[model samples]
Target chain A: MTTPEPDRLFTPPPLMTSPALTPPGLTPPPPTPPNGVPLPYQAAPPPTTGPSRAPVVALSALAAVFALVAGLFTALYLGERTDRDTIASTRADQERTLANVTGRQEQADATLETNRSRESTLTTQHDLLTQCVEAAKGYFALPPGQTPESSRLFRVMYDVCPQI
Target chain B: MTDHVLSIPSPPAPPRPRSRVAVVLLSLLVVLLLGASVLTIVLFVGAKEEHGLEVQRLDRTSRSLTDAEGRLAETEQTNDTVTDRIATLEAANAELHKCADPAKESIIAARSDDEEALRPAVRRAAENC
Candidate 1:
């Protein structure tokens, strides 16, 4: 058997170069007109951008949060103001009602006092009338068959005697 | 010949982001605040006006009450005076009734006529006639 000699100083084969391939399931679409004119243009994918959509979305979310916070604060402030006004109005109404009630109570008390005074005066007048009736009875108690003139004198005495 | 280096293509620029929604929301908030401020101001002004009217009404009522008080006092005074006058008239009437007894005159005449007067024994029986 003869031993084959090694290929010393042998040059390696050239590297194999491949053409760029689109991703699987992706295809280059036919160019379409943007303004009714046919043009050969490629649409840029959305992901490869200066700012990621996440940052813009975050900024938008922050702005929305700020707006919501401001709106909530404004709403609360307005609600508190409305409550203050309502409380103030209710307090004023209550005060007015109390004043009216107090005034009516005073009027009623005054009326009661006046009526009591009138009643006392009437009671005194009734006593005086009773005394007059008693005196008339005394005159009627005169002896029977007394002359009409004598009876008339006795009646005059009765009318005047009540004063003493 | 110049040697050319291999190059890599960079990604395309993304579309510029818009702030339309934020702008619209800010404008709406501004309008809402303006409307609320106007409403609050109008309500405050109306409340003040109502308070003023209430004060005016209370003042009018107080004045009327004062006038009524004065009238009531005057009436009470007048009533007292009338009561006093009535009492005096009643006393005078009672006195008149007492003194003007109709039978008083007849009683006095009866008493006087019952007492006969003798004139000096008729001048000693008229000097033996």
Candidate 2:
């Protein structure tokens, strides 16, 4: 009926008496494996990330190509727009200059025409003056204040003279 | 007799149609490229036309400028002619001013006895306008 001394000393280990050091207002973890209950905790296996290389590479390549093409189109569009603006500005200036020149040219032409007409008139007048001077050159004379016969001759000459 | 009815298996279901996303993306890219190209072309053509018109106008302006220069030169020549005519007129005016005064003086002196009596009338006649 007597038990071995080693069996008597092999008593179960003492249970933890200290309270868990959990923060205030937080629920403490359920008492781990109450007494001899089997543990439910286990390390999770490594996550199985599937193969994604091809699709990712394809999408990235597509995005890059699209961006490049779009950028090129934008650049071309900007260049053309700028070129048009510059050309239009230059043309506008030219048009304005042309308008001014046309006005000035018209004025000059009118002045020239007037000068020509005036000259023609002057030439005709000069010819008439010359005829009058020639007709009166030597014979033109005024008689003494009182002379009936001389007055008669002067009146006759005046009536007959073509250049007066 | 077991007849083996080897009916041609209906052609394997046509290969599944491509995903809508892939088709839509490709179509969008094509449409975008085409639209951009069209826009660029329109701009290019417009700019070219404006440039051509500008060139034509510039040429016309140059021709007009040349004509103006020639006209100006002709006007200068006309001005020279007018200046010569003016000089002629001035000479004529001077001659009128000199008036045959000495000849009139001789005639008056010869009529010395009547000089006093006819002085007013003769003086008036002798003075040129």
Candidate 3:
């Protein structure tokens, strides 16, 4: 009949045991407060398995950039190699053409020399023939019925064409 | 502890990573490329020098050929001149031969006087013997 003891305060459910948000089979780890004491009013900390390695990820990204640069350089080097090969072959071709031109020039020189010698021979023959004709003229002009005074005409004729 | 807890909310970003091996390799590659470029430059210079030398040789050859051609032309001209002279002389010689051969009447006339005087004497001498 008298007033009962003040009703006990309504108790709130613990955060770790709340099934409305937490995944199944996963339990929250014990809380580690700054003072190393568990507080009754706060939720527990989430579990952490091992140390993080963010530096290694950053280093891997840097390495990938370096590799990209090196690959570009290699491509440039290959292009240079092809250019060098093309230049070398062109130089060889030019040298071959020069050699051929020189050879032809030498042949032309030889032909020119032969022609000169032939011309000299013809000049000599012409001179001898002229002398023969002059001597024959002189012989014919002698007094009528007189024999030639000397063998000069005969000598000139024979010298004109030794075979003749 | 208070300072560390306060520092956790805004920690400095991690320092940029540097690859020492890659830097060294890049330096070496640059040096190698520079050396190769120098060598190529020297080769190009040498090739240019060779080209200049070949050009000089060709120029000399051209001059020589020109001179030879001139001489050949001169010789041909001389040969032609001589040939023409020879033909004219031969024609003159043929005319001289035509003139030198006397007519048969002239030859007979030259010897007929002596032969006529001897014919009457020979008959008079034979009758006495």
Screening candidate 3 with a backbone cut-off below 3 angstroms (N, C-alpha, C), the clashing residue pairs are none
- Candidate 2 is graded, for docking, as incorrect
Fnat, one value per model = 0.02, 0.09, 0.00
Residue range B1-129, candidate 3, lDDT tens digits: 221121213334433334444455556656555565555555555655655565566566556656655655666565566566556655654443332222112223334555664454323322221
Interface RMSD of each: 13.2, 10.8, 11.8
lDDT string, candidate 2, A1-164, tens digits: 23335445433324432245566676444333323333454444344343334544565566666666666666766776676677667667766766776676677667767766766665554554443333223223544464665455434324322221
Which ten contiguous residues of candidate 1 chain A have the minimum total lDDT? A10-19
Question: Model 1 TM-score?
Answer: 0.36
Rank order (by TM-score, best first): 2, 3, 1
Compared with the true structure, the alpha-carbon lDDT of candidate 1 equals 0.49
Find the candidate with the highest lDDT and give its number.
2
Q: What does the lDDT come to for candidate 3? A: 0.49
lDDT per residue as tens, model 2, B1-129: 112122323334432344345555765766676666667667666766776676677677667666766766677677667767756755653453232232233234434655654465335434431
TM-score of each: 0.36, 0.45, 0.38
DockQ for each candidate?
0.05, 0.07, 0.04
Say which prediction, candidate 1 or candidate 3, comes out ahead on TM-score. Answer: 3
Off by over 4 Å in 1: A1-47, A51-56, A138-164, B1-6, B9-129
- Stretches off by above 4 angstroms in model 3 are A1-164, B1-4, B7-18, B101-129
